[model samples]
Target: MTAPAELDAAGITDPALRAAYTTCRELNARHGRTYFLATRLLPRERRPAVHALYGFARYADEIVDDLGDGRPVVEKAARLDALALELDRALDGALDRAVPGGAMGHPVLAALADTARRYDIDTRYFRDFLVSMRMDTTVTDYATFEDLAVYVHGSAAVIGLQMLPVLGTTVPRADAEPAAAALGEAFQITNFLRDVGEDLDRGRVYLPAAELAAFGVDRQLLTWCRRTRRPDPRVRRALAHLVAHTRAIYRRAAPGVGMLEPASRACVSCAFALYRGILDEIEAADHHVLHRRVTVPARRRAAVALPCLARAIVARTRG
Candidate 1:
């Protein structure tokens, strides 16, 4: 990780900059409370940088994904792309010099530029993330696993790549990076499975029509609210296979738990197990996603975290 030759104005210690940092902290705590809670368990030095990374990622994601009007998608993407470039300049230490001439600060970017330096997070990931955001703006369905993976790569995998530096790992040690990417894919695929009806209403079918046809399940039953399961053997037959695909991805995400630093392992472990548990719930319900979205309760989240937490604690004690 390289340090900047000179500090950007974003991190200048003037009273106004200090106040902005305070505001950023409060805003992140407000909107990112859950991620903040998880980060609190990490080593103290790692927490702020990680929170900042998550804060920026979540903010960028909210843009194209805003879902209110198509208008926000275009506006947010432009802002995000510009913000990404500003971050890059701060990283290079050559630009982002806050001109001598009067200039207004972008509130979020002001804080994020310092966070990038503090953690050595790469600039490219932030840039690539928007390309993924563009996909969300235009592409919403999956025809093949290849296409699905491409979408996941831009949306989720790059996020893991961004976080890698904050965890204090080198690119070579970045071997664990792939596992992190897989874990994110697990999170995304679960979201898609759970949101099938919602996505379909927007004229998207995450579960391919071709694959559904294999089961004799028509689009109306899958997209409409009437039936959660099928009376036909072909539908039943196809769903069993679909459920397994969900399970397989969860299994793929499991090994990544150990890939995270021990202090950060608990949250990922809980998420992984809870998502797998949801898959089990889907199986138990016979894949009836329409009646309700499957969820692992708070109790279950705590229960899943216990084992990983204990393991992390024990490892620290020995060390």
Candidate 2:
């Protein structure tokens, strides 16, 4: 459906709010290719909420990772702090009372606060997300996966938790929360593997340091491989190990797909298949993710999405 149709279906009528949601939808379409494709399968009314969530996330991520802008770490941290405060005001219904350059002035925050209020999503999830975003300005690499879990819980797992209200569920929401969080972790791990090269360029290593060490790999060795544009046997083994580890996460997340309300299932299922397909592409490339990114081919994406789209139509019709 078109943006207007989506907003109308969601009962959004305020001009400023519609504009904010439109901005978010644009962000999602431009940056979240796989995610946007899956979102197309959701009931139209739910699409704007999903876009708002993605926009909120994508904006924060760009603030942390916008290497070309050359902002200092301190500046980035301050910006995040300001964003967190603005979010608080937005959530508190104080956006209209703000001074210049405040909560009322940011479109992404506007859409997010509206969605949160509409769905009654917990406020703590947003707070936890900012906590992780703040860590990016200081923490470089994690010492172990266990240590990384702290960051991931805030950065990824809470994202899944935040979405539960919007997605609806067949069981009690708490019953599906674990699997939802697991799916988020799986997606984040897949991203860590695929973007290992780019993350290294940003002076951050997401793969656990200890795990890489087990394969006789370290930042310097990985850097050398990146610099030389060649893969090492050890690096391949390390990446292969990570690939298998990520698949385990996907397995853990699988059960939640069945727990989502029927109308929402097709969208989540399509996303699950496509995100996991990245691992297939990475392995197919012989674990050469150190120098380049891998993606599911367009044809493969269509192959997965078409069937899901049909299923989504049928589910929506039945509902």
Tell me, by TM-score, which candidate is best: 2
lDDT, each prediction: 0.59, 0.91
Write down the worst ten-residue block by lDDT for model 2. Answer: 94-103
Model 2, 1-319: lDDT tens per residue?
A: 7999999999988888889999999999999999999999999999999999999999888889863247899899999998898888887762344222224458998888888878888889989999999999999999999999999998999989988999999999999999999999999999999999988989999999999999999999999988898989999999999999999999999999999999999999999999999999999999987888899999999999999999999999999
CA lDDT of 266 in candidate 1?
60
RMSD of each: 6.1, 2.5
Q: Write the per-residue lDDT of candidate 1 for residues 171-201, one digit (tens) a residue.
A: 3546777777776776676666666656665
Q: TM-score of each candidate?
A: 0.73, 0.96
lDDT of 2 at 23: 97
Poorly placed runs, candidate 1 (over 4 Å): 1-37, 70-107, 168-172, 208-210, 217-220, 226-240, 307-319
